[model samples]
Target: MAKAYWVATYRSVTDPDKLAAYAKLSGPAINAAGGRILARGLPSQVYELGLEQRTVLIEFDSVEQARAAHDSSAYQEALALLEGGAERDIRIIEGI
Candidate 1:
């Protein structure tokens, strides 16, 4: 089966404390769920209607695994902490 990826793009961060909490909790949750963080950073350059937001990319063995990770208790807890902390768009995509 093709691999899958979890992509999250942050539009804005409104609460630094909550963001920090999420960062701490999400790492372990992702790792325990067999997900690997591929990238996390600000865009170096932008073109067209480029957005000024942070981006995160995570790779999983399969789409099911990616979905599982998001639904896991640990990740759910992290999501609770991140709620309202930042405006983000997250999605799971199948790899080519």
Candidate 2:
């Protein structure tokens, strides 16, 4: 089965308190959907200029599985906690 890789980048955070809550909620949501958090944050070089405060890398069994994890009701419940929590950009790509 082909795995799916997800790279989540955060643009801005207006609410850290809410993000903490969302993180906790999402943890279980992702686990339940058969997803593994490969990495959450790793120090990255800043050659030019970029906001590299937060980044998440996750993997799933397949692209469909990744989509299912993100689109599930459990994750939706988790996302609800982030209504005004933080701003984010997420991308899921089929990997080798």
Tell me, by lDDT, which candidate is best: 1
TM-score of predicted structure 1? 0.96
Q: Taking the tens digit of each residue's C-alpha lDDT, what string does model 2 give over 1-96?
A: 789997888777799888888999998999899999988863466456766768899999999999999999999999999888788889999988
**Alpha-carbon local distance difference test for all models:** 0.96, 0.87
Candidate 2 — what's its lDDT? 0.87
Residue 96 of model 2 has an lDDT of: 80
What is the C-alpha local distance difference test score of candidate 1?
0.96
Measured against the true structure, the TM-scores of the candidates, in listed sequence, are: 0.96, 0.90
Alpha-carbon shift of residue 10 in model 2 (angstroms): 0.5
Stretches of model 1 off by over 4 angstroms after superposition: none
lDDT of 1 by residue, 20-86 (tens): 9999999999999999999998998889999868999999999999999999999999999999999
All candidates: CA RMSD in angstroms? 0.7, 1.6
Report how far off residue 47 is in candidate 1 (Å).
1.8
